[model samples]
Target: MKKYIQSYLGLHLIFLIIAMILFLPLLLNGELVTWRDSQFHIARFHELIMAQQNGHFFPDIIKYSGTNSWGYGLNFFYPTYLFYPLIFLWRLTKLPVTSILIFDIIVVYFALWSNFAIVYKITSKIKLAFTFALTYVLTAAIGNAILDNVAVVRIAYMTQYASNIVILLAPVVVLSFYNIIFLHDNRTWLRAAIYSSFAVMLSIPTTLGIVLTVLCMVVVAYFKRQLSINNMNQLLRSVLLTLGLSAAFVFPFIEQRLANNWANLPNNPDLFGANFSTVLMRIFNLSNVLSLLIIGLTALLIFYKKFNYVYKILGLSYIVALLFLYSNLFPWYLFNRELSGALQMTYRWHFMPAILGSLFVAFAVTDLMKIKQKMLPIVSVMLIYLSFNGMMLNTVAKIAMLMVLIMQRTILLHLTRIILKPIHCLA
Candidate 1:
């Protein structure tokens, strides 16, 4: 009990330090207030608060062009979905929107911490799990998304942040789903259903990614004869429950959007003449040292025969599919022009894959470390090469430095243990 309390306190201290480090710059520079994305969300929250005060439920029509439109126009306030809890706080206490903004940032960090705890549960390595979680939060995808949001002042695009929050929950959702499908744990199925439902509610694109990943897992399970009839039944039940819960929110939204001719409607063609090459370039352009680390580590794992060939192949296939989706391929291809038109610019759709790549790297790194061989130098060189890439260059550098610091600490701890052994015997 005492050890548990000490560990809890230690984690809290670590989180506090990390939060301060990430938050200090925004606080000191006063950029937090002026950040364009921040202003837009704050504005949307105020609008919602005002509507609530006037005895209206949440406003269906968010003014995008200084006028409220019902169907066709973008609802810029959708990103504020998670902030529904904070809405109550605003009503009860009448706190300034800025205060809520600060609070939300803290919430995001806490969400991140929770995500770290989940990863640790799976990996059973606090350091590696925390490293993976930190990488996810501090990656260039997040930094760039925030920077763009601040620069663009488009609240509608806050979907990026929403997607990020969903990503933080993904490990837990995936693990739960795996347990339910493979182990047939009834309680696990219920929990997984709830988590999956929440994930689907958060972002459709992310939900689609999760579904695709599960499909891939299912195929692998089938080929390996790892799935039995009972397991399949439990998996189906979990998925059905998740889908049913999600349909409550999803159906109405989809129907409304469809009726109103939503932007990026299905069956659209490539209006911008975008080809596979352009999409590929976008993928390469977004690639960073961390991304390279994931790729390299994944390759090394396969080469060393650490993972089964099928699992390794599936991992690689998933990465490729992610890249394809990010690129102007089938489904995303159809909507590329429409989304670009709505946003008034072309942003790399590859951002999610880049973020997911970190997890692949984490899994690979954990596997590699377990093998008794010289792998550090190979990873180090790859990191150096990746750091040379120009995208989110500074953040990538920080990540690389953090990894190095961690490795150095491990080495020092080992050496200290070795040096102390002889002295203890002599004493």
Candidate 2:
């Protein structure tokens, strides 16, 4: 028991140390880096707290009589889900905004850690798990999206911060799903419920993606005969519990908002109008660069029949996501606009498949290494080095590190065969 505890602590310590180092640049500049969306989220949180202090249970929307009677807006309501915990902390210790910013970093770190641990448990390979976790958290796309719109341009709004929180929670969602599906542990059912509920409360956009993924997993499990009666009962109960808990907070605001005209609510058009050619181009563009290496690797694994049942299920989920991306109905768009009204944006929907594709690739690479006798350690080292360097540096440095990763993978295969022949004979 002591040994197990020690092992867990050792692993967590390593993850924390690496995560902190990777996030150091952002931590140093995060306070100064104020995006409009982030500012909006912070403002909303402050507004809610102020309203609470004034003995109001809900945020009072200020309306100008005989002018713009825009009705009571729920813009301030979004952050309440994230702010409640912070408010508790603030009540215990009267810290300023700086403390909240620090708290955000800590929360993000734990989110990343939980995400990586979940991936590791699935793949049972430390190197691949670490690589996927690091990449997911610090992906160039995420950085580009955040830095381009939020940090440099000073767009302070709720979406930016909310998206970050969503990204952090994504792993938790995936992990919970993995636990319930593959491990079949009863504890995982409760965990999945809690995590999924928190995910929905954090950002409806991310939660929408997660729901679709869950649906796909459920369908696949049912078809594959993997869903036992016990598992099905657990899943249903968990979903019900999550919904009931969330409704306690969500129903009042939803009722209030829906009392106003739901049809004429804000609509986002950017999600629609992407033609087949454009969708193909986007997929191709991701593939041309090494960005979609994981996607390619997943395909290769499926082709070779190397993937296990669990991996096959995840792989099918990715395929379903792709099909949805191309479908005429644009289910993601409909779901997003329906749930959050003006809050749903189209371009961000790609994040769902991107994460799943990366996980698939990680699994494929690890499985490939297992089959190829001698290349495992070499490729593992390369991934570790690249993950560290990639996290610490910016564009040019990251590019160089990625190139090194590719070259190492190529050379290690040949080196493995040559080195293992003599050792095999001696053995």
Candidate 3:
């Protein structure tokens, strides 16, 4: 255990430094960075606190806009389970707005850790695991979607926490299936069922995601012939049990929504959403150069000989899934009109790419270690150009940050050697 601790101490140190560089410096600058929905979310937090004060420990609905005559509440359509614990903590401690900012930061970092766990399960390489985790957090897609100036962004009002929390919980679902389907771990059923229930508690957007992801995994396993009828039966039983476990929220919520159906929502979608790109990109225009790099990297892995066949399939499938969603090839949105309404935006499943794409990138990026050292500079420049093209910085500024990061890592490693060497000598 001591040897194991020493082996990964450097990596943990690097993760801390990286996380600090990304969030701490900007967050500590004493300015709250928020988007349009920030005030609404802050208001929601206050209302939840008020509800707790009124002896309603779990608030079913909160008055919107603070007037009973014009009140609107989202509880029937959305679940706030993800934020309950944090709200309770705030209720007890009475922390300030900075606490909220810190909460967002912690959620994004947890997402990076989640990405790492998923990739590590697939590749089982520590470096690749850390690299993919870092990629998931810092990638322009995730950065734009999840954060604003190091704070989690205001996307879904009170449910902004859902975006990051769901990303963080995604791997647990995948890992659960992998255990039950591939490893045949009997103990994993309890875990799978619980994770499924917790996932459902996250709300409709995530509930849809859970159902889709589980279905996808089941299909993949069926194709691979790794699943028998009994295995499928077991998976279905767990999922059904989750629905039962989730009834406290799900049943009441669904009944309320059905009984009081919004008059504004129509039965027919336009077949294509009004905001086409918004449905897909969610207000962020991904750099074409970056897109190509993502595609190119995925293709390299698809053809790469060293990776497991399963990984290659999974990676390619992820890319294909993105392409379908990004384009109009699939009618999943039109088919699931109610889900589209629940998501309230395009790219409802944006978290999918952030989770699976990291695994794919980890598989592809690890092979770079085998490349000749002389071409390292060229590869480094290419990576910087591809990944950060969306940032809109001048070329020089982009290259400068890349060079600085490289230099900082090098210096940190040298200092780590010096620091640990003295400790080692004493021990």
Candidate 4:
């Protein structure tokens, strides 16, 4: 036992150190970095605190919240299972906002640690695992989807929404589904089911993501001829377990929405008449150069003569994920019209590529590092470019900047090598 613990101690220590560094502002400054939906989420946390104090452990209506204090059913409509830890911390500390902030930092750490541990479990390479984990956690910042100054821009700001939970558990779901389907690992299906349940409990957008992620995994398994009766049975067991586990939220949410005639929430999808360029822009902003690297790696893994089963699965999953991302652009929607309405924007599918693409880049970069050390200069330039190019910039501007970046001597040379001998570069 002692030997086992010592062997894994480095990962734990690295997680803690990086977490503290990332969360320094929230901890030392004693404040949250406010952004889109921050106020609404803070109020949700406050309602939880209020409900607990009023002796309503699981209040259907938060009488202390809503317009004119008429009692809001926010808790009834949205699952708060993910926030129980925050509530517990609030009870212990008696500091409502502080407790929420602390819990936010904790969740960030959990997200980082989970991604790191899972990649390591699959690859058994500490450097590769840490690179993937760190980049995945900070993808938003790396892509300039959030602020440039902050290292963890999205995480620093978006702590209030349960969407964070969806992001946190996405990698786990992907990996478990891969294990159950491709490896015939029946034991992992239950784990996948439980995490999928947790993910779906959050909201419609999250449920869509979890369901689609599993579907993509299964589809890829089938495409590769890895799908089997046992795989199907394991998947069935996973679905049943997921439904049973999520019933607490599923049943009540359905009941309340139906009883109150709130079933038809406005979807208001913005992609109805969006042109090709517009859709491309959305995908481009989804992860910037990370998306390019993923596309490159996935192609190599899928088409290369020497097949890599693990990466091929990841590649197929990314391809399927792209279909969903582009589904909104189609004349007829791919998902149920009603369900598609739940996603205000089609880019909600970004979570899928975010996880898979980061893993792809991790595999690519780690291999490149081993094979040709000289390519490090181009990788550095691309990383620098990603940091400076904000997501809000126009598509043309981003492309222009990228073209300029590619014109650099080192990057230009690397691009040539990549085009000429992509397999050699990756392998």
Candidate 5:
């Protein structure tokens, strides 16, 4: 029991340390950085704080704090329950900016923990789990949410979209689903439903993304002959419960749509085109090391034969489906036209790839570390150089530098084995 407690504390301490390292710039600067949607998030946060202070516990109308105090029923349309933690901190600190910063740290730490938990559950290797978790967190997918310091030059911000919630809870949802289906653990079905409900509450697009991911895993499992009658039954139960638990948001969301006049709706052909273009650009761009690493390793995992069933199903096939959905190849035009109200933007699909891609990259790295080939050291060095280059070029300097240092230590240790091999051979 003491050993268990010590191990748990040590693992979480590492997660906390890494999260703080990622946030070092913002913490030192003592200010919240805005990018793309952050300003809108800040506005909504202010409105919530105002509403709470005014004694309207459940605000029906968002007080337009900046203008003539007009009210809009945004809370009815969008879920703000996920931000309650930040709100609680805001109430305690009475410092909105500090509240956001603290909230970001909390999100990052949990995200790391979730990623670590998923990887560790699969591999049962502490070192591999930590490495994969760290790599997963450093990717551009997650950087879009919490890594939006002044140092990061990318159009990074996901608060209004609540991708941070996706980042924190997606892995948990995936892990629970994995347990239910692959492990045949009926106990995890409810856990999967609960986490999936929270994910959908934050973003319906997240719900779609997770469902698609689970479908991919389900397909892979079926093909592998690992899926069974019990697995299918458990999956059905979990999905049903997920829908039931999410009814709170789903019912109102549907009612609002049904009651409202639908004569006019959003039409953005250019935005649809831009989404495809953005995915291509982000993938090909040399500065985006995280995306490139994910893309590269995902391709490798799909082709690489050595990865176990979990890595192949969870990492390879899932990522392929996600990238396919994100690509121009997917019939986004027809899909969007049919269900225009369902998704605000198509790029929301990137959430899953950013997440699952990280898992695959960790899988690739872990497998590479296990190989006995001496040339592996040279390969590791090249990867380190490219990763370092990506970090420096992309302006995620401080966080990247810390990650690079850790990678360097690991790679250099492997390189030393190569260096000593000649000496031992000579002896």
Candidate 6:
């Protein structure tokens, strides 16, 4: 009990420091940081409010363009349940948009904390958990989809999309994979099922991304004789539950696809056209040092040793991630019309592999430390720095840094209530 207490409080203290640093710029500033999609997200939030006020009772379609011709569009099909809690808050109290925005940021903090918990559960190591969570929270999650598209999800204040990645997407992939691979007891299946059902609401693209990654993982684990019938059963149950829960949104998507609503969705060469033969060169030349280190460490688990099924699964997952990341390199478009169109934007599947890569790195780092490798801490630090603010060449990066420095020094700025509210909640 004492040890657990110390660990929990210590985690909160660490989290507090990081949170303060992250919030410092916003605290000093008088306005919100409107990144690429930030302003558009704010408009969507207002549209959500409008839909709710009309007594729609948790609307599926959010049509703000007033263009009935856009025909219910993404607002109807796309998932926005991540914002539902804010909607509930609006109903309970007349909270203004600024307050809601602040809460959105706070929710992001909470979700990142949850991410740490997932890592801790996997590795059973404190430092490893903190490092993984810190690396992910501070950095751009992997270069999922495209590097620039990363900002649309992880940053730029698209709260729901961001929440989907770190909060729901990360946990769903890692937790379910761990449970399926290690735990054989029936006692845990019910809890797993409920979680699987609930979290599938994050979004279809991300859900499918994880699902596909796990499917490949399951096959790999089984062929290697690491997974038994019971383990496969557990995995299947969770997957079925996820599909069942997401059917509300997913079925509609399937129907539209069947009607060829996506027939015109082209596999644009400019967007994803990279040859498979060039991936090796890209890895050597253009990959992040952190990701390279991650792949190296995990690969060592497979090549340098034998029968390390855990690392084997992770190794296969890394390959799976790369495959989806560069899916346009394949000839899938020549056959399977539905699949080709559904997977037209293969980079979207990068979400699952990103979480998998994070897990592999976290696990690999912890394992290396166990072996007392030299300079490991320095390596981890370098990776942490690189993972941050994905696009370094952009003007937004310069402006964001300038804003943070300005706000960090302006400690006595005119913002007591905004800062104090979260502090009070933390206390």
The model with the greatest TM-score is: 4
What would you estimate as the lDDT of candidate 5?
Answer: 0.60
lDDT scores in order = 0.53, 0.55, 0.54, 0.61, 0.60, 0.53
Report the backbone clash tally of model 1: 2
Kindly indicate the candidate among 2 and 5 with the higher lDDT: 5
Q: Residues 76-165, candidate 4, lDDT per residue (tens digit)?
A: 435676778888888789786677666756766777777776666666786566667766665622122342322344545653266655
| Candidate scoring better on TM-score of 1 and 5 | 5
lDDT (tens digit, per residue) of candidate 2 on 222-257: 888888888888889889988887776667657767
Please provide the root mean square deviation of candidate 4 (C-alpha atoms, Å). Answer: 9.1
Over 69-94, each residue of candidate 5 has an lDDT whose tens digit, in order, gives: 32222443356777878888888888
The sequence of per-residue lDDT tens digits that candidate 3 reaches over residues 189-264 is 6666876676677656555765677787778877888888778777878878888888888877666666663432
Clashes of each: 2, 9, 2, 1, 0, 1
- Candidate 4: stretches off by over 4 Å: 1-6, 67-77, 140-152, 219-225, 263-268, 271-274, 279-289, 292-329, 332-337, 372-427
**What TM-score would every model get versus the actual structure?**
0.62, 0.67, 0.68, 0.72, 0.71, 0.66
Error of 4 at 230 (Å): 2.1
User: In model 5, how large is the Cα lDDT of residue 178?
Assistant: 79
RMSD of each: 13.5, 11.3, 14.2, 9.1, 11.0, 14.0
